[model samples]
Target: MKRVLITVFAAFIALTAAAQSPIVQAHLEPSHGILVGQPIRMVVTVYVPNYFTGSPDFPEFEIENAIVVLPQDRPANSNTQIDGVRYAGITETYVIYPQQAGDFHLPREQVTVPFALAPPKSTIAQVPLPALAFHADVPAAARDLDYFLPTTALTMQQKWSSPMKNLRVGDTIERTVTVTATKMQSMLIPPLSLDAPSGIRVYPEEPVIHDQKTDRGDFVYGRRTQTAKYVIQKEGDYTLPSIELKWWNLSSHRLVTATLPAVHFIAAANTNYVTELPPESEPAPIAPIRHRSLWKQYRSRILITSLCCIAVALLLAMIWYWLPRARRRLQAWQERRRHSEATYFHNLQRACTQNNAAESYVWLLKWIAVADPGVSLQQALKRADNPLLTSDTNDLGESLFAQRIQDYSWNGKRFAALLRQQRKDHRMHLSKHQYLNDLNPK
Candidate 1:
């Protein structure tokens, strides 16, 4: 009977290994060299037999020195039959932008997928699929441009409610510039700079961005609009400088420029403007009389008073600049001390749970040092003079450094319990003192 059971178990293992495994594959799109800061696509696919129901859990990827972003788009799913066997599969894509010009490899990872293989799909099994890897490089061509983005097409246009011609002082004109790019994200587009001629005050609003896709959702396009309100300051002729955007054209395999035309306008003074002048007045001449001794008598006292006032002002200014900074430094120091104390205590507890006598002793010493730098663990235990804590520490020490055949066991549970009780009592006493001090602070 035992032999038969062993044979059946071996057959089960063989069946699972041969018949239930899913096909896993990975690849990089546009799999060659790409410019730095240009996005590359990583695709992972899992094909399971039709008997398996449900999807696979794709792993999250994080690469050093590269920006990896999970695609917001949904994964593609399909069903196909190959060699008279039906299969279902899903494909997931991720976007990555290399930050530096160097070779990088995405490591392979095994993923476990949960699926049901029976009718009504009640029973489930987790199958580990094969790992996948990808490699790419940023070549010397990437260093030629400071900022690079590959796109299919780009366009820019400026629109306004009225023509920018023959405007008066204080007149305001609103102009909008819109940029559209195909097969690219709006965030990759650099900010547009529009230089304004002298005598024009420009108040610009935030740029509005929009992303859209085709009806079939195959192609994506992004639009960004920047608006500004230009106010005529001095009445003179001015020209709005031309704006140009340089982008790499994917189809043409070269750089192209999208241009916005320059605008010229005349701002004339308002004809009905009026100017007011101050009223004219004739002043009477004063006869000069001076008391030189009276001025000299009080000059020394006045100078002394002014000097004292200046010294007080200087002291106040110094205090105003440095008091807040000193307070912040003090706060930061206290926070660090609190965090260190908490971490040391937690390490002690963890060491005790693992029944590591040497580690526990070291963590106990560290906790005492952080809590009160002047006290050692042995000294603290003696000063507390608690029977339970002292006994527990003695047992732990003996277990760590025993002489009789090393036949000692550390009671971690009892030690931890006694330490917790001691800490609770210490906190209560400390809190009482703090409360009393707060009531009558000196």
Candidate 2:
């Protein structure tokens, strides 16, 4: 009886195995054709004759990578199907692009599936299909032309980092500007450029940028960073017109213009440019001096004595009010002086940090300028002889600026600060007669 039961179980297993091995095939739905540069869809169907319905899960099917060539820019979608009893009907489709004109082949993959549970470990399966060759011929005219020659892009950006809205005489301000681009060039170059202001200074870097192309489009990456400084020795509110840049777009094949918003700032002057209002017109003329009587002089003396007290009170009041104001002004001036000294050293440090032969040599010019305001920058750089500063630089400066220079590289910041610092520090020079006059307070 046990043998008979085992035989029955074996027959059931055989039946299940036969049911799972379904016959499969693939075929394209459309018999017509597809163009080379256009989009086309093809349906692949597999017929499963002995589809299993025993509430059993089957092995999943998948295509190999790279083996299945997806044409340039072609999108593909796929699925599977089964038939008979509990059959799964799935249809696989492919979006194909034939990049080049050629004959191609589509071959079937070998698929393996396990079936038995406790007896025979598993069964090997072969996906039955043959390779089919297809032709992809492009127009002879397109073979010689390049597809990526022209491109176009549009980008916009804004920034606001400028200092004082109201710039006064003896005050210097800097503006931080940012420029965005569509199809831009080297970001290493200075992005922000100004029409050199007579009393203002502008500093910037050359542009350096790079980008790579992706599926959607070419991605652009670059940055232009610079400092545009302004020194206004005059006073007034001014409006700078909108900044605009024009460039040719390759994709659109046209010229494009980008305009920035307008800029507004105020300017003010120091004591030298200011004055108080005067009466409409002066009295016609003054009469000649007159002599005072003795009685009048006695009355004048009494009045003078009272007037002297009032005058003293007024003078004291004026001093009381002005002393605080004077202190604050003096403090502010000292702070500015300290900042100036700090900056002189900072700039020299920056120049030294740059190891590039050309940049270091060029910054050496700025270094000399910071050290000696009256010395021509070109002349000083031309005479640079530290080997770090090129020997040719000296000749370049002389040939360029027509000035004699002492060849040297500034290795210290104190000298740079003292370039102009000495001018103010020694202004208190006292002459023999002036010191005597100060003591007398005449």
Candidate 3:
């Protein structure tokens, strides 16, 4: 029984260690024949003994004279058995395009992987990537081409903004050319030559290049659009030169030339066109140069000077006449505003709202004096018959004048409310008294 237990424990430890070990595999899709500007798939797969706790950090590497593309797709997952032990695997793919005919090598790099050996016990492992190499050469048929574009298919189309017939001078016509290809990048597409013949002006716009892909993140095709506007400067027959592009077709394994046919158009002279008169035509008689008297020459200056003088005189007279009257009116308005009971009451309300005890007391005295001249604050409060107003005013006076602690605080919200009510009642009483006197005519 003791020997059996020891064997069981040792077997479990060996299984655990084997499950935690990670393996990395990398290889090019086609290790044999490759052509320049052709995309080659490089797939890297990572395997862990049990399961993955976190995503594996794949290293990005570049090859000389080649372009690499890593598609933004989810990593492929699978399950397999290695040496009778269950293992989880993740596969990622990268595309590489060789730009020149040469030998390309992928250097070895490290990939960080996090996986679980057993439930709730996960660990990270650094795995080294396997080295890869491939060779690319240009085919015999495409050797003479300056620019090599390898694609499965290619197509070109052209359109005009308006009809090319019956064009008149100064008319503008725009031409647009679009090139599309599969298994290629739009940036690799070259620009078109849209040169116009003499008597027409060409204004070429910047080319637009974009790539399209399916919902599964698979490359569909690449498209490039170019536009140019031709303006008719003079009336004549014009021919826009044809455009040609040479590319290597991967499907046929041969060089293909796509051509845009030449366009021809005629422009007619405009009937309403005006041009400089020829010297042979008789010249019109020159207008006689006339002489003027001194008064005529300076007539505008004389009138301006006279008007300015009259305006100055009028302005001076108006100021001299209205200055004293304006001063007198201003003085009268100031006196009325100073004696207004409403102004004094407004100042009092402002001071109370600000919670300024001393300022509130001073304004209260002034307001009471204005409401009833020669009356004291206490007398005014008593005559108003507002007990709440009287109480609040007394509190305010105590806060300002009475001896109190240094930390004493005062709130003016209640006092301001009571003051407003007292003012309203006093105004009502005064209005009633005035109405009765008017009826009695005493």
Best-performing candidate as measured by lDDT: 3
* Per-prediction TM-score to the true structure, in the order listed: 0.50, 0.25, 0.56
RMSD, every candidate, angstroms: 19.7, 38.7, 30.1
Q: Which candidate leads in TM-score?
A: 3
Compose the digit string of candidate 3's lDDT tens values, residues 33-83.
Answer: 898767788889898875654557788878888888764434666667777
Instruction: Please provide, for model 2 over 42-112, each residue's C-alpha lDDT reduced to its tens digit, 9 standing for 90 to 100.
Output: 44433332221111112223332211222221111112333334322223444443434455555554433
User: How well does candidate 3 match the true structure in TM-score terms?
Assistant: 0.56
Question: What is the Cα-based lDDT of residue 7 in candidate 3?
Answer: 100
Clash-forming residue pairs, model 3: none
Model 1 stretches astray by more than 4 angstroms: 1-19, 35-41, 60-88, 93-110, 116-146, 213-219, 271-442
- Whole-model lDDT values for every prediction: 0.69, 0.44, 0.79
lDDT of 1 by residue, 1-442 (tens): 9999999999999876456456677777767756555567777767665432333556666888777766442556554565555555667777776765567777555555533343323223444334433444333343365556567878898888787776898788998999888866676677887668888878899999887754433328778899999977778878888998877776766777788888888899976533333456798788797657865889999899999999999999999999999999999998787558788788778778777666576567557766766554455777788987887887765654343336665677677777788888888999999999999999
Q: How many backbone clashes does every candidate have? A: 0, 21, 0
